[model samples]
Target: MAKLLGLDKVATFFRIIRGNGGIFGSVKTLFRTDELKIGNLIGEDKYGNRYYENNAYFVGRNRWVIYADKVGLNYDGSQVPAEWFGWLHYKTDLPPNKDPSRPKYKWMLDHEQNMSGTNQAYMPYSTTRPKIESWQPPQ
Candidate 1:
């Protein structure tokens, strides 16, 4: 059914039905599943995101991205680390695997999920602020 809809195999019939198989309409369905053609196994990063390409994009179509099998909790965009960022957006001509110029540093930070607005959010400290504000009755 995905073939008929011109969508990736991971995409469901419901999404294709609802989105009508257009790029703009597919935004809502983005990250919902794997939607790329894998003519070749590119490379994997420490966080386990996989990259693939079909080379069919010559006509400006048929590029794809497949999240690792371990990424089950949910994709929040921040799941994608900086290393794979280049391959994901076609920024580099080589995949991380084939790229000889890729760099590694001792101070490199691990991938961190975006936790803003969530319960595990970051807390800032301020020495001048009072712990509790005085409650005042409105006049």
Candidate 2:
């Protein structure tokens, strides 16, 4: 119960100091009021992302992935790779490890988490000069 309150950790002291003990942590914390998902952890990937499946399927779907990082700072759809995305969204019945048909082509590049809004974003070269110029100061 103390853990649910975010009061049990020494790290919480630092977070409290950082913010005078206002609301901290995240949406996942609400669901993790108990350790409901911890025991159901079926697999972890190289990046420390964990995968789970609840046996109780409302229709026919029972798969989910929890990232190591919380949703706010690290949240982005691009963090999920193509292969794992397939399994997460029910496009494939097999996990990446167990799937034999997954390829190992030499020409293929490793997947990178997206960098669209960051400094690593793709920039195309322009062949044409800019039509509009800044007004030159009188000199």
Candidate 3:
């Protein structure tokens, strides 16, 4: 009966608002990620990204990460380091911090996000000359 009368949606709206800690929280969340949700904070990475989980939500959808404020709206999945990536993808139930078996070695390099499309992207040096000649602009 509630579903037929559209009361379910109304209830959900209020529930979301309440979960976010009332009106102000809802607005803050809206500006931040545009989604209102309630969940327990699972962990935080060194990059300042925060991970959250809520069993009430569907399995995959229940877990998520909020990127660091420094990334602003430019945040991408690449920014998630390997340690956190494993948890995010359900590779392991325990987070990096909780997993004592994980190995750390002096030879291991620190994680870095792919920079293929940005100004820092790698450029190769060419040793051979081009077959085609370029036209020079008039000075």
Candidate 4:
């Protein structure tokens, strides 16, 4: 019955149209080249990033992440917490929260999203004055 009405295709079309699938997300789906897969959610990091895994896919590519930020367009990889990073890269089998051997060091810093191109980007403090003063026209 679903095939007769083409509900699958219709549903996909709507997902793309509604922006739930992203701007080019629909394009990727239409081409059958989408890299992301729906998998069993393993856990969510402190930053609210969700991790997923599906053994059905290849080993290295099986694990995936869904950013916590609703604005997928602005999502960045650096947003992933260090603990989750280990699992995402196959460095550890257990999520950070679940790993018993994981250590907590006082020097460890909290996870911070990448701010390279934004106003929040870090700027080093320098004591040196400007090399060239404001240009002055000949008197």
Clashes of each: 1, 0, 0, 0
Model 3 misplaced stretches (Cα beyond 4 Å): 1-15, 18-22, 131-139
Over all chains combined, what TM-score does candidate 3 have?
0.78
Superposition error at 137 for model 4 (Å):
8.7
Predicted candidate 3 versus true structure: per-residue lDDT over 52-121, tens digit per residue: 8888899998888988879888888999989899998899989897899999999999988888899999
List candidate 4 stretches off by more than 4 Å.
Answer: 1-36, 130-139
Cα lDDT of candidate 3 equals: 0.88
Q: Residue 23 lDDT in model 3?
A: 96
lDDT of residue 14 for candidate 2:
54
- lDDT tens per residue, model 4, 1-139: 9978999878855654454366566555334433435567799877677788889778998898877656445777788887888889988898877778888889988777889999999999989998889989999
The superposed Cα distance between candidate 3 and the true structure at residue 138, in angstroms, equals 5.9
C-alpha lDDT values of all predictions = 0.62, 0.64, 0.88, 0.74
| Candidate that would win on lDDT | 3
Clashing pairs in 3: none
- Per-prediction TM-score, please? 0.58, 0.60, 0.78, 0.65
Q: What is the lDDT of residue 8 in candidate 3?
A: 93
lDDT of 2 by residue, 93-137 (tens): 788878888888999987788888889999999999989979999
What lDDT would candidate 4 get against the real structure? 0.74
